[model samples]
Target: MSRKTLLRAGPLWQGGVSPYGLIEDPGAGGLALPAGFGGRVVARSGRKVAGLTWHAAPDGGACFPDGTGWIYVSNSALPLVGGASALRFRADGSIGDAYRILSGTELNRAGGATPWHTWLSCELGHRGRVFECDPYGTRAARPRLAMGRFKHEAAACDPDRQVVYLTEGERDGCFYRFRPGDWGDLTEGALEVLCASGGWEPVPSPAALLKGTRHQVRGARRFDGGDACHYTGGVCFFTTRGDGVLWAYDARTSALERVCDGVLAITSAPSGDLYVATREARVDVITPERAVAPFLRLDRPSGAELTGLAFAPGGGRLYFSARRGRTGGETFEVAGPFRGAWAR
Candidate 1:
């Protein structure tokens, strides 16, 4: 077994009032927030937003800055019953349009948004590969197979090294890294499966693991049912839904640290603050120091689980999907005096 440390940030990540103070929702939206905070129903499963029904079983998603507006990519978790869709939000934070991508793909799962303003949607139920396309949801001529075809859950990029870290959403899922050949281009890359220093053989099968390619890693930490991943400040986080453990990976030291627990979706704010959406239906904010606290809790009449958590490039707004038990699915955008990098 590898070493594990309990995450406890000193004071910096403790308590600080953001410019966006506690705001209360008007009660119309399902979300119950602090004061000054506001929310809007961006889209829904059976209903249409910009002419496209909100994708079913919305699992993982991300938002990309698009000129004065933004493009939000959503993933569907139900195998063969769902697909990936992209919703374009106008400058005013309204849905301008929506479209389909990853068509013909199975179980479009969790993924990360690339700096290139594209979506790296993963196929969790089928080919176990990631399909890259514009936020508009165009069909990719080819998926980035070099990233390895596995039971993947999420992928986050280290903008500095131009490398991406991927997670396999399995009971014994292995962490991986895809180093692209050219900067900013994910078309070609080398795939490496992680393992212990004393052990090698690339886990079960490098061919099935990498789907037939060679390549990286010595830190074989425990990642049970790794579900969501986010990279920032030389640290990457993996939320293992099965065991409800959060694994924090340090690129600088190659150290894998266990952070929080009972977290599902991990979205990194532009300012480097990490937001965690929990199965408990609450959103917690984690500061650079790793201190975490509940940020938002949603109340649904029909019962639901929060998913597809994403922060806008401007950081003033957040878009996420709420799974409404009998009512179906819903998409929402919460905005306030959020603190972070502004749109350039």
Candidate 2:
């Protein structure tokens, strides 16, 4: 019930065995956590709990706070038929219910929470669309049509600038920004692609920005391959899986910085630091400065890809899902004394 948070996780991941003493998970659940840290099984694919059957191929996810509990939303990346779900975490830390919050969709991947607690589920298709969803399942999913219609992958807002930065799901696709007249009102806005424009810069302007994009952030840094991105501490961090690279674009200085390589998916802690799942079947941490270190080694028998991971509001626990193999499409919550930005 009480875990000792880490003062420092020993300089990212500098070597052979983990510097921090992470005990072996006895259940053989394919995860290892630091000393004073532990995990529990919240949801598995084959189980029927809370009056709803769990779905497989769960991909991008987000966690939100509820009236007295928490809700974890995950998308199905399964081709042809992918839907979104919201799993309620009761006050006792157990699941209250799990339901399909957004239905009749395909390729639900990489969604994020708005300040208002609603979610934006991204459709990873040729004409990428973003659907606004309610974690409470109070209403039907609302499609953000004016946002853009392209191979949309990931999006995050800069609260200070009232702009939302977006990433494409292609190797040659571009990075973009959407600025609305007011904060969180994405209904009507101008969308524009980012061009390297003499060494890449973060652009803002509901007036000058393009309404959306068609993989055309002319001149901006193009990835060999990438899918998800987020905005944190004034920087937009994204990953290019093909090139195995992680990038951070500082809108303040207009500097686009490269951070990690061989990265697959990325999620940020409350501290604004990053934990990235690598193609090597391992998860690594990326500090704000771009320092990389091994966080956890995912040892799966058949070898699966870590699709998505998200931190709870306080960063005390992490929920991650993986795809492929026998135990495919499973979600796990790793609990520990996770040092949050607030801790500093």
Candidate 3:
């Protein structure tokens, strides 16, 4: 099947305004053919400026159809305390109306959409939590305290096996899976933290002594609020920044195993392949056999911090967001030349 590659370019909005930096690589071309990619200013939020630490981060976004011929993106605007906003974009790259999903949450990072069409926004701070927001903007947002939230990063939902996988974004975070008591309705489900043993295990405190080896526990103290998905069968993966370890939560045996380390973000491809993004502006393909290799490296300079990664619907292309230098941000679309093939 032939894949369609549609590129939309515009300037990213910061501080409720357009920074309007150079979009294309000036050295590569005359900036006339749109050498790299252009970014469109979607929406701006400046009402509560006093509460925000910085301008709209717009860190992570996912593409989803919104009844009309447009796609909606749940953007993580504020870093730690500000809420996330949902913005719709047209096929022509025009920005649409913006809606507030959840407010007063900590560090709304990159979250994945549930199979049921709800957005699971994760907090990236020490007091992180997850909230489910309706894309239609008619439902009240609530936190799933049973999920044991603590500095969450991203979440992916399987929807087929009725399991929602979650990621913790801490120095030595743990991967978690929430098996809701009822799959039909997510609001009233029993949330269980992934455990190695049959019961709860204590997570060590920050001051706990650790000399050489790492300790694996069954359960940590529940945060009464965390970010997660209500979708079923989603793969649960988490990243630990200190050692750069990625762990996959096993649903069948309730055990966490090392899947991939030295990566920043993990997203499952439509072909069941896992794509891991590193902070070094490179992405790797992790295979079923646990082999790791490079897929693509951004052509930008070294200061480009690759923050968010998401696969376009149908898995034809991969998209990543990067903040280059001090004030510029760009999203790159890599054409999938090799289908079902993992790269470096």
Candidate 4:
């Protein structure tokens, strides 16, 4: 999606070496990566990076292109102190600045990046909501009440459909779709829940005044513990930890298929591989060919789960956060040739 070459859906490397050839020894940060790749702890909670303290319990994250470098925004899932923060990188990949983008939100967890470049940070409890924040930190974050109120996990914007698909984290959570009157405007939208028949029914009470949004729609399908979401190549991919299933919704056919098992946070690579941070302390890559393999493993010091997963602008660098690291929480960067690996 960043103007990089897309990995074909067919067999990769054609009797050649895989991009993830062989994992090298663990780095100083305890992350095992493939050869030609390196990892380092970029930031930690209770510590400062670029003069600003990194938020604790870093959960969901996304990367946006800046003038030459990029900005990485991560949501803090610590209750009552939850918010989202951003780190701006200079062209040389050094920290240019770090600041808060969305403050005062509670239990901010996984969210998706909008095609317009805004980050949709979702709150993670019964009273949760979606906050559209400017990744650049220039504009104040705005809460979109029209997106409905529920225990939200993540959101994925399908530019072609002009709709935003949201995942709920409840045990019996419902997959939701929001259709805005205008493409980029999220202020007013028709919130609908997905039905088992592939049809959508308007949410009787998006505010959930009478009951929970999931229950308001009589026939709305329930997803177990929906987690991270990502949209790419006409499909919307999401994960459910309750059942450990990775789901793919074909936008064109309006069909849902189970792609894999074991998931947490998910991000798509420019090469068409879906990198998923599992409930386990590792990240797996689901290639376009449907072959799944371990991409990276963390010798988690705090026995924490992997949460955030996002690729830098060119997809050469990957950024993810350990929900609870040695320093309470930590964000790590893995640099390799993931983007242009096919041509090697």
The number of the candidate with the highest TM-score is 4
Runs in model 4 with CA error above 4 Å? 2-18, 325-327, 341-344
- For each candidate, the alpha-carbon lDDT, in order, equals 0.71, 0.69, 0.50, 0.84
- Candidate 1 backbone collisions, by pair: 22-34, 22-35, 23-34, 23-35, 23-36, 24-34, 24-35, 192-216
TM-score for predicted model 4 compared with the true structure: 0.93
| Candidate 4 positional error at 266, Å | 1.0
Q: TM-scores of all models?
A: 0.85, 0.85, 0.64, 0.93
Model 1, range 1-344, lDDT digits (tens) per residue?
Answer: 01122233443344555333453553786577767677778877877778876677777898877779888888887766656888888897767889887677767668887777778888775337787877765546258876776777788988877788888876766777788899678777676666655222333343364442222243564467778888766777778878887777777666766665678887776666777888778777776555566677777734677888888777888888887653367778888766565742
Residue 62, model 3: Cα distance from true site in angstroms:
2.7
Cα lDDT tens digits, model 4, 60-145, are: 99999898889999999988779899999887778899999998888898998998999999998776999999999899999998
Residue 337: error of model 1 in Å?
0.5
- Of 1 and 4, the candidate ahead on lDDT is 4
Query: 2 or 4: which has the higher TM-score?
Result: 4
Predicted structure with the largest lDDT when compared to the true one: 4
Best first by lDDT, ranked:
4, 1, 2, 3
Find the 10 residues in a row with the least total lDDT in model 3: 1-10
User: Model 1: how far is 3 from its true place, Å?
Assistant: 26
